[model samples]
Each structure stands twice: as structure tokens, then as C-alpha cells.
Target chain A: MNPSAQHQDAEGARLGMWLFLFSELLMFGGLFVVFAVYLQRYPAQFADAGRQLSLFFGTGNTVLLLTSSLTVALAFEALRQNRQRLCQGLLGFTILAAGLFLVNKGLEWHAKFQHDLYPGSQTLRQAPAGQELFFGLYYLTTGLHGLHVIFGGVILSWVLVQVRQGRIIATRPTMLENGALYWHLVDVIWIFIFPLYYLLL
Target chain B: MGKVIQMGEYFRRGFLEPSGKQPALFDWIFSTDHKRIGLLYLYSICTFFAVGATIGLLIRLELIAPGRTIVGPQIYNALFTLHGVIMIFLFIIPGVPAAFGNFLLPLQIGARDVAFPRLNLLSWWLYIFGAIMALSALFGGGGAPDTGWTFYLPFAGETTTNVSLAVFGVFVLGFSSILTGLNFITTIHRMRAPGMTWSRLPLFIWSLYATAWVQVLATPILAITLVLILSERVLGLGLFDAARGGDPLMYQHLFWIYSHPAVYIMVLPPMGVVSEIIPVFARRPIFGYWFVAASSIAIAAAGSLVWGHHMFVSGMSDTAVLVFSLLTFIVAIPSAVKVFNWVATLYGGSIRLDAPMLFALTFVLLFSIGGLTGLILGSAATNVHVHDTHFVVGHFHYTMFGGGGFAFFAALHYWFPKFFGRMYNNRRATWAWGTMVIGFNLLYFSMMVVGMHGMPRRYYDYLPQFTHLNQIATIGSWILALGMALMAVNLLIALRRGQHVGANPWEAATLEWTVASPPPPENFEELPQVSHGPYDLKRAGEA
Candidate 1:
């Protein structure tokens, strides 16, 4: 029984992640302030430009991330029950959900790029003035979230390696709990992003 | 043999008797003990103060005749920038907290140490690293940062100076400040001994608690903002560039978001000092203790939102300016409440006019001037008139120097006996204080008058109408310098010649006074359960 096999440290690790998540929230809060002011100043242009986001892809990514969060939670539960094989299966499902999200995001970005709506591109040079802001925010939010997904994947892989080593067991599932907490935050942020970017229109 | 004799006598006179069980130089550098780290901070900050004061002397000398007598404009710009950078970042930011707060907070609160002692040591080392990097800009391609300490972009980005390194230095410094604040917050939350409830905690801890919040919440914004500026300088990120469709006003927003709360970071610890000092001198429990304590948190919270006030003339929206102006005025209410509480504490009480008390009394007056001028700035109309003028300079000196700096001196004087286990001559201390009081007013007050007469600030030379007042300020600077020199002399002499002090020389009621003058490596023999407020001098006397 490895010391890391117990879930006793889960609460501390989870709380630490939540605190880090709050700081991330505030970091993004600055950009939101800028966007809010700009939106207030150019409401119609913002709405017109926001309407261009592909709701189908946005909704698809949202569902992908939300489902991944459930699988990650179930993985933690499986670890609690000492069901290592099921736990790995659920994490594999969670990683698959992340893969689907990345594919959807790539296609959406490509579509926007084909339409020449990317920032500083000649396509956006002649587009509606507010469209540049739309693209600016679109790229920033999606790029940052994409970075988070990469970070989350790396974290999950570490958890997976720990699982492979028999390190994450019922009594020491803290690492798994912290991973689920982080994945849930990523899902929660996307929940806001989907409606704010794609559904606001 | 001679050195051995001196060391032996030093030990016998209570050096190694009890509190002098501290180790050699190796123990100092490698020690993670909070008290040792605190002493390290005190020595380093005082060195920075001296360096910054030297820069100040150069500026005053240059302003003596107002025609580049001491240096050229380029040199002058660099001088003032160095003064501001060293003083604000190195001196004032860490002034009371790292110096007195570090030394006192845990002992006063009956805690073993800060929650993270290793982090405390790291914060100090990081501060040293940041200081070295900042000073390194002097040897870079351009000599030091000339963008003022604010480092507003466009000027900061394109200002052909060594701003990139300086700003990077500041960014790193911001990290150190954040870590220190974080460490203090965790300590206050988790490290208090049993029965040290929030109400029972000393007001100094409350002030540190409030200051820590600003450090945690506001400093990262500064970190991000400085990083943005650094990227814009090095790699052309357009976060604040006006030409690349970025808003320059955003830089102001980001800078002040940390800086406005930084003012509280500067003032709160001294407010804590005044809280500690007034009760001991008045020989009574502090009146309106809750109000005084709450006002510190109130200032930290309200200070955060009013950063927009700094950008009133920076092309922010009318709505923002209006809102921020209102918020700025509202922010002053808490400071006034603290001031009123201090005065009320002095009322009908047997107030002892010790050197520390005299400085505290002077702080009350000087900070009033600073506060009243702040009201004028808070008004949208009056600010437009004095926004870039010497009046703002005067207001700042009055606030920072008269308010924070003077209170810091008071704390130094108040705690000198406790720190060094010795006492200085009262007569010389009085003389130093008198000259300083007059000299400080002469220097800053003349700046106000010249500022009101439509003279812009930060100029190497002014029009002749301002010449007389500038000359007066120069003269006053000399006087102030003389007084400060006297203070330094008195402290040195006290260290060598003054009478040895008892632990409770001022008859103070705080826990730090209950033990040796400089307590043992472990602060207390046994952690006492605090049963009374820190200012319970009456109870102390009865005991």
C-alpha cells in the first residue's frame, strides 16, 4: 500500500486547484472587461459579428467537454471502488472526448480562416470594423482554452501513468480527484464560452 | 586580543547573555527563521532608503538654481526615476511590513512563525534578486529607466531608454511582493495559536491581513501588465499599443489596478504602527478598536475599485471618470475614520510625548494635509487643474512621506529599544524631530504653492516665477537632510553610548515586550494565551 494510494490528500489537492481556478477566472476577467466595454460601445456590430460563430461546432465541443468531465468524475469513482481496469477505461473515454473537442475546434478555426475572418488577415482587413474585435476575442478565447486542453491532457496522462504504476488506489486517489477537479473547471469555462461566443447571437 | 575584549564585553552587556544566542554570519544567510529573515529585510530596506535618499539629494541640488546646475535634463530624468523606483519599490513597498510587521506580527499574534517560513526566506531572496536586476539597468545600453516608476507605455515601449530591463526587474519584484503577501495571508489564517481569534488578534496583524489581500489580488495584475509591456517592447504585443488598434488607456488601467491598492500596501502597516503606538502612549485601551481595525480592510477593498481615478484625464469614458471620482472620494472616508479614531484615542488621555509619539502626532497633521489635498484631486474639476502639476507631487510627498514615512520613523523610534536593547538621548531626538517637521513642510509646501501657480512637475528647470519657491524647497531639502542625518547619528550614538534599555521601556502592553529586549531565537518561552487587547495599558499597570 503506497502512501499515494490513499485518497486522503484529495481534499487538499482539490482545494488548491479550485483556488488556482479562481485566479484563472480573474485573469480572464480582465479580457472580459475589455470585451464588455467594447460590446457596449458597438452593440449592433458586435451582435452582427457574433452571429457568424458556428453554433453547431460550438455546441458539439461543449457537449464533448461536458461528457469528458462526467467520465473523469466516474474514473475517480472507479478508483474509489478499487476498480482499476474500469477506471482506466473511463479515463480513456475522457481522453477520447478531449480528442473530439480538438477536432471540432480545428474545423471551426479552419472554416473561419477560409472565410478570411482571422485577425490581421487580408480577409478581415475589409470586413466589418467590429468583426476584427470579434475575431480578436474569438482567437484569444479559443486559443487560451486550447492551451488549457493541452495542459489538461498532460495532467491526465500523468494521472494515467500513476494509475499504471498502481499509485492511484482507493485510499490514495488524491491525484485522480485533483485531475477531475481541473477537468471540471475546463468544462465549466467552456460552458460559459459556448453561450457567450456562439449562443449570444 | 583587542577584538576579543570588545566581543566579550558586548556579550556580557546582554549581547550573548540571552537574546544574543544567534549564530554567526552563516546562520544569517542560510537561516529560514522568520525573525532572522525579518532582520535581513530591515537591513536591506534601510540600505535602499539610503540609496534613494542619495538620489533625492541629487535632485534637490539640481533644482537649487533651476538651470541644470547639478546635471542635464537626461540625467535629471534618470535621477527622479531612480528616486521613485528605489523608494516606492525598495523602500516604501516593504517599509513597515518587512521591517516591523515581519518582526512583530507573529510574536504579537502568539504564533510560532509564519505558516510558510521557507517561503518567507524565498520572498526575501527574490526581493534581493529583483533589486540587483533593477540596479543592473544602470549598466545596460541605456542608463536606468526614465519612464517614471509608473512606466506608462508608448513612452515605456518606445522611450529609447533601458526600460525593458527595468520593467522586467519590476515584474520580478512584483512576484516577490506577491509571495510575501501570500505567505502572510496563510500565516494569519492558519498559524495563530489557540485563542488568538480575529477579535483578539493585534491590530498590526489586521493591517498585515488587509495588506496581504492587496498583495495577493492586485499584484498579479501588475505582473501581467508588466509582462504585457515587456512583450510589447521585445516582441511587439499590441496589448497597449495605440497604433496597432490597442488602447494606451488600458496600460493605465492595468498599472493603477495594482498601484492604487499599493498605496494601502504602503500605508496599512504604518496604520498598524499608529494603532500600536497610540495606545501605549495614551496609556489606555484604543478607543473604537473595531472601527480602526475595520477601516484598514475597508481601505484595501475600496482602494481597488478607485484605480480608475488615476485615468481621469487619460481619455477614459466620462462615465468611468465620474464613477471613479465618486469612488475615490468614497475611498478617503475610511482613512478619515482612522484619523478621527487616532485623535479620539488621544482625547482626555495622559499622552506621553516620546519621540515616537511626537512623530505620530506630526503624522496626524501631515496626513491630514495629504488627505485634504486628495479630496481636491477627487473632485473632477480641481483635478483637471492640478493633474500634472507640482501640486500632485506635494500631495504625494505629504501622503507617502508625511503619512507613511513619518509613521515608519515613529515605529522605528518606538521599537528601537525593543530591537536593540538600548535608549537614545531624548533631547537630540527632539531636536531632530523639530527640524524634520519644519523642513518637511517647507520642502513640500513650496511645491504646492508653485504647483498651484501652474507649474508642471518633473521639470529640470521652471519659469522664474517658480524660482523663489523652488529655491525655498531646495533649502528646505537641505534642512530635512540635516535632520535625517541627525537621526542617523542619534541612532548610532545610542547603539554605542546610550543607556541599556529594559524590555518594556515604554511600558508597552504587547506580547513582544513581555520577553527580552531582543527575544531569544524562539520568540517566547511559552506561547501565552492572549486575554486582553494589545492596548490594555491600564490593565498592564494594574498587574
Candidate 2:
């Protein structure tokens, strides 16, 4: 193929990725629509469930994700400057923060498990039926978010190795740019999930 | 003269060097070329259609008698559910768009391939995998999903069957559809030839653009909605269980939000296809070109807002019902506008009633009937009485079968030359079209009268009062199925005996027609730089 054709193909590839991201937003948006409708249906229970959630961990993960998003953005800048080591280092830090968010999520879910709030548990004998609904949603929303964090961590780690090996370059860093975009989306989803799951107490 | 190579020399290329050995299986498995991948989707979705159609045939066959015939009522419920699920999700929704749209969109727009071809391949694979999962659910401890495709709550959540796996299959299919939509939207925006501006592109491309938008924007809501339904079933969650204080009506709202636009997703591409075929056989440019294109976008935009029409009698507020009913009628205007424009394009023109034109003309007539009937259903009062009756089922088939089905035929006839590089016998083609149009109306139209007389839909049997109409519908289905069988035979026979195709078979001006039939691996020998609108046949000499 012609070199100009290759350039045009690359542009199409980039635009395709952005459109894919837009779809990802809607896929998750479906879950959010359910959340909004359910909130209207069970406003008191949903808010009460939020009060029981650990705001401390939720806030901590939010700040951690926000900072990691900044680091990923900075790594894209470093790659543009051809500072491969700086880019790798920033990507590594971003991965570490994502891992930290996941570990906290695990601890919080475990604490809920210990309290016998998991959906199938029989320990919550008082108001046992509809109460399970609240925890069911909690697991679903946070579990999907956790899946994204794990996916983002894998992608960032790959980008780090690529940056260290001199594969991603200044002008040809679509891989890095897309990875950063994915991480930012993860952070942005958390921005909404935080209020719905933990805040509004 | 040019030293030598004559017409027969060009004709010999498709054979003798036909590459008898399958291009490495990996060529198909990992294909990044859009045309090959499009064929891959066409074949896979055809397999799904066969399965769905087989289920449909059985359901119709069983309904021939008032009582259970070959299968019991329990199995009958599951049969229709699978029929609806497989047909709606696997076949019709992806029918023209993924199969023909993917095959032609890039070529029509003068691009080398889609914006992202690997994702295109992945979408097909995902659809296959989802279909397999859905099919395998039959062997689970309980029978496959007995709840309808909607999987309405209480039935969905409280059912003892393996609804979870079935729902999972639907979710994956929805994901596949969303990805395909994303690819088309990006390709349309970024991959047009240098001079192929949006307004000048073909109407089929415009319809695809609108369908893709809905796929990207609305399909995800269905994904999450099904997920909530699945979890509620598996984990005893109370998301949509009314007894558990969750509103079942919310499920209807969420489901219709995606599924309603989904009707447009199925029809719009075919409408775009008819728009292309009509003018070609009429020997004139399409009338109200902008109106046809705008109608596509308008249908897409208006289609999304009127999902409330589906829930008009599901205990929604009266004001909400009124608003939705009005919007439903408003949405019909664009579809009506498209029908009128196609008719006018045929006016004052020399019309050749070839197979493609026959199907296109049939589309104009049938879609008008379907759209007009949709107006009756859109009224709140009529909807309240006929909410779950055969009337609704008849309305759906009128649009899906009448609009989507006829448009699909129009496309098949229009693009057969390009796809297989051959054309079917025109006489057989015309016969097939005639049988299909008559059989389709007989099958679905009778249901409308039966339903109006108070026969509910989705029932295993009806009262004696509705027996006559039901018998007519059942008999009509046989004719309709026979017509479908005839079409299948004709299409298969065309593969071998159809007329040899040319670079531009119809002499219809479009970027796709500029290339060889069944096009080469790269689509073009040299990329075309466009300078005018696609259908400007008169300007061909100038270009």
C-alpha cells in the first residue's frame, strides 16, 4: 500500500478506537440507567445501603484513580518528548495505583462478606428479602468497575514494557494514547460509581 | 486495436484460477479484510437464520392444529421463545447490516476497507459464540429459556430453568451488535473517499449511519437491562420483581428502549437498499434525494424517543402514553416520506421490472401498509385493548417482514451480482418475488383481523370464535414458507447458473460498481478519488 494510504489507515484506526470508547460508555451507561431507575424505586434502601458502605475506601480509591489518570496523561506527554524511561516510570506508577484500588475493593467486599451481607447468606434474618437487593447491586456495579481496573492495569503494564523496549515512539504512540484514554475512562466511571455506591448518605 | 485481450479474456479470470483450495482457514479466522469478513458474517448469520427459521417452521406447523400436534405446550412455549430470540437477535437485527452492509459500505464509500477490520472480524465471531451459547442452553438441567425474548420479570427471575445462560448469550450478542455499529459509524465518518461528501453518499450508507448510531447508543441499555434480569434470577435480587418492591414496568421501559430502535436497525438498511435499487431500474435519479437521506436520520432519531409507545398500556402515566402515542405517529412521517419518494422516483421514468425493481416496488407497497397499520397501533385507546393481542404481532411482522423482509429481497437481488458476480434467472426471480409478496401479506395480514376480534398472541391455542382467522393465518404461513423455500432454491441455483456479471452490471453509478464483481482482496486496483455524488449516472462521462 502507499505510505499516504498507510497514514490514512492509521487515522481511521484512531477514530475507530474513539468510537469504540463511545460504545463502551453506552454499555456501562445501560447499567447506570438501571441504577437510576432502581434508585427512584428504592430511594430509602439505596441511600441506606450507601450509608453502610465504606466512604473512606471509596474516597481513597477515587483520589487514587484521579491521580493515576494524571500520571497516565503525563506518561503520554513523556512519550511525546521521547523520554522513554520517564514514560515507563509513569505507566508503572499508574499500574500500581490501579492495583491499590483493586486491593481496597477486595478488602471492602470481604468486610461485607464477613458481615454476612452477601446475597445468598442467611445471617441477615431481619428484612432479609429486599435487603439482598441492595447488596446485589453493590456487587454488580463495583464488580464490573473492578473488572475494568484489572483490565486497565494489564493494558498499562503492557504499555510500560513497550515503552521500555522503544516500541512506542513520539509520532507513533497510538498504543500509549489509547491506553491512557482507557485508564481515564476507568477513572471517569469511578467518578459516577462513587456517588451512586458510597456517597449520598 | 489494443493488442488483444477481449471480453472473454476478462470472463476467464473468475474461473480456472478460482483458487479451489480454501484460503488458509486462518484467512477466515483472522481476516482483517472487510469483504471476506463480510462474507464470513453473511455465512454465519445465514446459519443462524436457518436455525431460527427452522424453529419458526415448527411453530407454524404445530399451530396448524388447534391443539398440540407434534410437541406439547411447554415445549411449544420454549420453541416460540427461541424462535423470537434467534430471529430477532441473530438473524433480522444483523441481517442486511452486518452481512451486506459490511460487505458494501466501505466499497460504496470508496474506502479500501472499514475503519477497523479486525474488530469487524471479532464482531462476527462474538455473534457465533453467542449463538452457540444460546443453542447449548437447551441441554442444561432444565429446558432452554421458556420465557419470551423479553424475559419479563417474575417469570424470568423466579423461573427454575437455566435462564441465566440464555440471558448471558443475549448479552454477548448485544455486545457483538454494538461493536459492529461502532465500526460502521467510524468508517462512515473517517473513511469516505476524498470527494465523497456525506450528502453525496448513497442512501444505504445514510441508513447504516443512523442504524449504527442506534446500535452504539441503545444496545448497551439492553445489555445492562438483561444483566439486571440475569442477576435477579441467579442471586434472588429484587431489581424487577414487583412483589420484592421492584417495578416490572421498569424492565419494559428498559427493554423497549433498545428493542424499539432495534426495529429500525433491522429495516433502515433494507430501506437504503431499496432506495438504491429503485432509481437504477427506473432509469432516473432518485427524487427528493435529501428527503430520503433525511428520513433515515429522522427515523433513527425519532425512533429512539417513541419507545414509550410499547409501554402505553403497561400502567404508564396517561400523559406519558399520550406523548408517546403522538411521537409514534410523528415517527411514521419519515417512513411515509421515504415510501412516497420512492414511488415518485418511479413516476415519469422508464421502469424495468427486473427482480431487484420488483422487490423494491414490493417494498414500497408493503412498507406503506406496515407504516399505516403502525399508526393504528400507536393510538393509546387501540393499544390498550390490543396490547398483547395478535394485532401487535401482526403489526411487527408487517414492518419486519414487509419492510425488512422485502428490503432484504431488494438487496439480495440488487447485490447478488456484486456478491457472487452472477445474476439469477430473471423469470424465476420475478416468480419468487411475486409469491413472497402475496404469501407474506396473507400470512401476517390475516393475523391482524384475528387479533382485532380478540385473539391474544403468544397463546398455544385460541377460542373457536377466532378459529377461522387463525386457520387462514396458519394456511398462509405455509404459502409464505413455501415462497421462502423457493427464494432459497433460486438463490442457490444462481450461484452456478446465474448470468456472468460485469464490472457495472446495472450501469448504476456508485463507487462499488466501479470495481470488479466479488472484488479483489484489497477491494480496488487503485483507490478511487471521487469527484461527484454516487448516483450521478449522467455525469459518468464527465468523471
Candidate 3:
């Protein structure tokens, strides 16, 4: 939303971001469809696989992502009120939350790998028919979501820099708003993902 | 290298208006101008088109006889696979939308540039890079993939032919497509000039709008699908491979879910192209404008639901097949509505069979044949009979090549005056159109005929019974190639030495024609205010 010498449309920028977020939702939506079909085919196996995942890490990452969404929205509001310091602090907090989410995910995957439960492992292949697919969908959905968190962090960090330089102040918050929108999408996908993968049991 | 010396600055200025600070080639590459970026896409897409077409000719020649005529089985397999990938991903999918749409969308909508101009340049770059990555799979690592463009599962998972990189290339291409859709949607929503209401918009923009939605909503599914392919290879996930206990049918479901709508993304813009040209050459207000406009969106929506038709023979449930077959039949209505409308528009008017008109009319004929044959293939019984046969191959070629490909050629002829401010030799263009159509119909129609007679597709060798049709199709490919060469040469000559034209050479009533033949750097000297219907014969200039 920075006021360029040329005309700018903050509203148009927001629309573009929302459209992009729709793509992200559908991308994950595809995996959800795959997961749903497999769940129907091997419901008991999928539920058993669900119970195998560490609930503590899943819950922790879920909470972390939900809270990160809040901080980003607040950051957008603070940018609007010209509280540059609070905006930067809140944005930084959002990225830190993303980092923590990835850490929790890494720990969960590491625990699985230690037990030979990851995709393509002999143990996973030897397990029940549907369980390997469950783990496959599990890693694919969460891993892609992790990539999003990383991307969200990078986008927010850029916005933070722009805010720090006074380029993204109250009168020009399009960049921050778009970044926040992206972060919120990452959170929303995790919300669907956590329920399907961790809570279905 | 692209420098074609122009007589006036207006024509050159539109494309050469250095939007970036860089010099020469870099300037063009880095340009954020919609016009320049469109030309960038035009050049790159054409080069890819030539490569793909030549490969196609070779494939046809190899299939001319029962046994291998040129390449070995492996290389022949590679040739057709690359041809399909190149033609589908690199050429036809981006055909009209990337090149002409970029150049014309802003011009028609009365905008200086797309809503996200810098992002427009990024889409073209992504396109080029994705194309390179996809092509590199042929020369680098293992060898050219014979997995086909669909990259069907289990086999794609098992194949050692650099399938991952090729799939990854398409994933990147999907991003480019999604971004372009986002930009076009935003620009249409927020950048239309005052009084340029939705109904007043040209049908081409409407087609692009519908196309953008399909691109945004459907392509991401493909992105994920391709990512799964990479996952299967790199991370050894093997979600769709049977040996790993993964369901193979799921791969078909996911791929077609995106790809069926992808058919719309490929053909819809050309439907838009035909819509624009019909009224222009017919010199008549389009019959049933609202119906034509609504049908573009209708085709897009209905097209999405019919992905299951592709799965009918994959052992899906009878109820599922019934529903999908019904939806496939239903989707044809909208397209039929469009074809009827085009014919009606031409019925009571002074029609000019210019080069563009000739191609557009042929598109109507070819697309009609294609769409009707699609009904035969869509019927569960008939479709199962011809599932992976040459009939299926012929069906798609008719729809994609004859329908979309011809419309792209029509758009090229239609817009050449506006794009270059010059005219090609019309006589040569007609001869080219004739040869291409004759060749195109002969090539594809025989495939459909032999396909019905039970010749399987993608077979390197054919039985003696299918030899005559195969030979005919081979000859057709030669003629098609000759016509393509003639058209390319004719247009290239016009780029430099042709006679110049005025603002409205064909007297089109769209906003684009109201500007200088080659539009200014900023499309309009003053932003246009629309006060009349786009096709009003009485209205020449803006209010």
C-alpha cells in the first residue's frame, strides 16, 4: 500500500492476495481429498495410525499457528495506527511462532524416524496396508504446510523490514496486509490438517 | 534478435518502451510492461511450438508404417511423450492467454497495465524456466520420460526416466498459470475504467475471467499432484504406487480432477478468441451475447465436474460413472450454445473471409466435430470401448489442436494489424489456412476413424490393417507442417515489410481498435470512457 508516485490500489492488492490464498487452500484441499478416500478405505488403520502420532506436538503446533494468526492481524492493525514499534514486534513474534511450529513438527518427525515409521521405511511398508498411505498423506500435508510456514515467515520478515524503514507506515499497509493474509492461510490449512490427522481418532 | 524495424514510433514504442533500467535483451526480459511481456511470451511460445510440431511430424512419420520407420521404440516413445508435454504445457495451454491476452487485455479494458505489472513479468519468467526444466529432463539424467504428459501413477513411480524433474517443471508452470490468473482477475475487477461495466466488456475478457477462475481453483490441485510425484521419487513416499500398498486409482482421480478443468483453461480463451473474431468479421452484433458470455463461465463450471468421465473405464462405480457421464453430456450444452451463436451471428451479415475469419470459421467447424465426438467418448459404453485408443487421441486433437490451435492462429491473424501496425499477404494466409485445415482434419479425423476400428494409442507399431489411415495421417502432418511454415514466414515478413494500417483496419468496435494500431506505452493517451455497447455499429469512438 505504499503510495507510489504512480496510482496504487490497496484493494486490488488485497484481492490478488486472497486469490493466491485460494490456490493454497485448494492445493492442500487436494491432499485432504486423497486422505479422505484412504480414510474411508482403511478407517481402522487410519485411526490406528492417527493414535500413533504424538498428540502433544500436534496440539502445540496447532496452538502456535492459531496464535501466530492473531499476532499478524494485530500487527496489521498496529501498522494502521502508526505504532511502528508494536507492528514490528508483533510481526517478529509471528515469524518466531512459525519457527516454533516447524520445530515441533521436526521433533515429531524425528521421533517417528527413530521408530522407522516414516515414509518408505521397511517398518512402515511392513505395517497394515492403509497405514503406509496414512503416513504418506501425513508427511505430505504437514510437510507442505511446513513449507508454507517458512514462506510466511520470509514474507513477514520482509514486511517487518519495510515497516522498520518507514516504507510500510499507516498510509501504506498493502504489503503488510498481504503478508498477514498469507500467514493466516498457513494457519487455516494447519487447522484443517490437525483435526483430520491428529483428532480423527 | 527480435528487432523488426518499424516505420512509426507508436508501434515500436508499445513494445520497446523500456520499463526496466536494464539494456537491450535484459530490458525486454525485465520489462514490466504488459505489451512487452506479451511479446516475450509470444516469441518463446512460438519457438516451443515449432519444436513440438517438428517432433509431432516425426512421430506421425514413424507411425506411417506398421514397423518403426525412423527411431527405435524407446526413442519413438520419447518423441510422442515430449511432443504431448511440449504442446500441452508449453504451447497450447499458454497459447492465446499468455501472448494475445496479455497484449490485448489491458488494451481492451482501458488500463495502462495489468493490476500487478511486475508479477506479470514473473509469470513469463516462470513459464520459460519451467519449460527449460521440463525439456532438460530429455537430455539430463536418465533419458526422456515416456510416462506421457498425464504422468500416470505406479508406472510414473517406477519409471527411471527423470520423471521427477519433468513433473517438477510442470509444477512450476502451474505456479505461473495461477499467478497470471490472479493478476487477470484482479485487473478485471479493479482496473476497468469508469463506465466499463461488466456487461459492456468484450466477450474475450469474459472468457479470460472465466479462464482465470478455472486456473486459480483447478491448477493448485495439479501442483499438489505433481508434488506427490516428486515425493514418490525423492522422499520415497510412493503414495500412488501399487507395490507400496498405495492405491493406483487415486492418482488418476487427482490428476484428472485438475486436468479435466485444465482442458477448459486450454480451450476457453480460444473460444473467447473465436467470439471476438466472429462478430468482427461477420460485421454483425453477436447473436445472443449474454448466452455466449454466460456459456463461457458455464463451460468452465460444468467442465470441472466432468473429470470423472475420464475415470469411467478405471473401474469406478457404476453410479459414479452414470453421474460423470451425465455431467459430460451436460457440459456440451454450453459449447453447443456458443457454436450456434457464432453461426447465427454469421447468418445475416456481410461476412468477410479474411485470413483470421477463415481460421475462425474453421475453428467453429473443427470444434463442432471435436465437441460432438466428445459426446461419443463421454458416453460410458462408447468411452470404455475407445478409452485409451486412437479415438481418444483423435478426440483431444480435434478439441485442442483443431479448436484451440486454430483459434490461436485466428487470433494471430486478427491481431497482427493491431500488434505490428502492418498487414500480411492475405492471399498467402488463405492458402496457409487451407492447407492447415485440410491437413489437420485428415490427421485427426483418421485417428478417430482408425481408433473406432480398434487401434490403441501410443503403440510404436501398428497392424497392417491400420496402415492406410496411418499413412494418410502422416501425409496430413506434412501438409500441416508446411502450412505452419508458410504462415510463420508470411507473418514474419509482415513484421518488417508489409503495408501499414490505420487504427481500425477491420473496423472493429472494441476499445483496443480505437487506439493507435500498435498501442502506446500507456495503452491510452487518455483513459477511455465507455458509453456504448462494444459492438454498436453506430459507435466508433469513446464517449
Which candidate achieves the best TM-score against the true structure?
Answer: 3
Docking class of 1: incorrect
For DockQ, candidate 1 versus 2, the one ahead is: 2
Query: On residues A70-174, what C-alpha lDDT tens digit does candidate 1 reach at each position?
Result: 999999999999899999999988888887788889999999988877767786557656666666766776776887888888898889889979988888887
Among the numbered candidates, top DockQ falls to: 3
lDDT of 1 by residue, B1-543 (tens): 012343354322322232234557656655666777787898899888989988998898888785778788888889899899999999999989887877787778776566556667778888988898888887768676788889988888888888888888887788788777766776676667667778877788899999987887888778767766776677554545554456778678878988989999998888888888888898778889899899999999999999887777888888988999999999889999998998899888898898999998888899999989998988888999899899999999999999889998898899888777779988899899999998999999998998999989788987877789988998998899899899889988998777766668898777788767665566665777777767877555221
How would the candidate models be sorted by DockQ, starting from the highest?
A: 3, 2, 1
TM-score of each: 0.84, 0.95, 0.97
lDDT of 3 at B362: 92
2 against 3, candidate with superior lDDT: 3
Q: Per-residue lDDT tens digits of candidate 3, residues B258-283? A: 99999998999999999999888888
Higher-ranked by TM-score: 1 or 2 = 2
Report how far off residue B302 is in candidate 3 (Å): 0.4
* Each model's lDDT: 0.80, 0.82, 0.89
Index of the highest-lDDT prediction: 3
Q: Supply the TM-score for candidate 1.
A: 0.84
lDDT of 2 by residue, B1-543 (tens): 112244444443321123335666655666677777777877887778778878877876676667677888788889888989988888889999999998899889888788767678789889989888888877769887899888888788877777788889989999999989988988898888778888789999999999999998889888888878877876666767665556788788888998999989999998999989988888889899999999999999999999998887779999999999999999988988998898899899898988888888887787788788888889988888888888888888888878887787788888888887878888887887777777787778888888888888887876767767767777787787777788889989988877778878888888888877767666766778788776687764222
TM-score of chain A of 2: 0.91
Candidate 3 local lDDT, A28-65, one digit each (tens): 98899988888888899999999999899999998898
Q: What does the interface RMSD come to for each candidate?
A: 6.5, 3.3, 3.2
- Lowest summed lDDT across 10 adjacent residues in model 2 chain B is found at B11-20
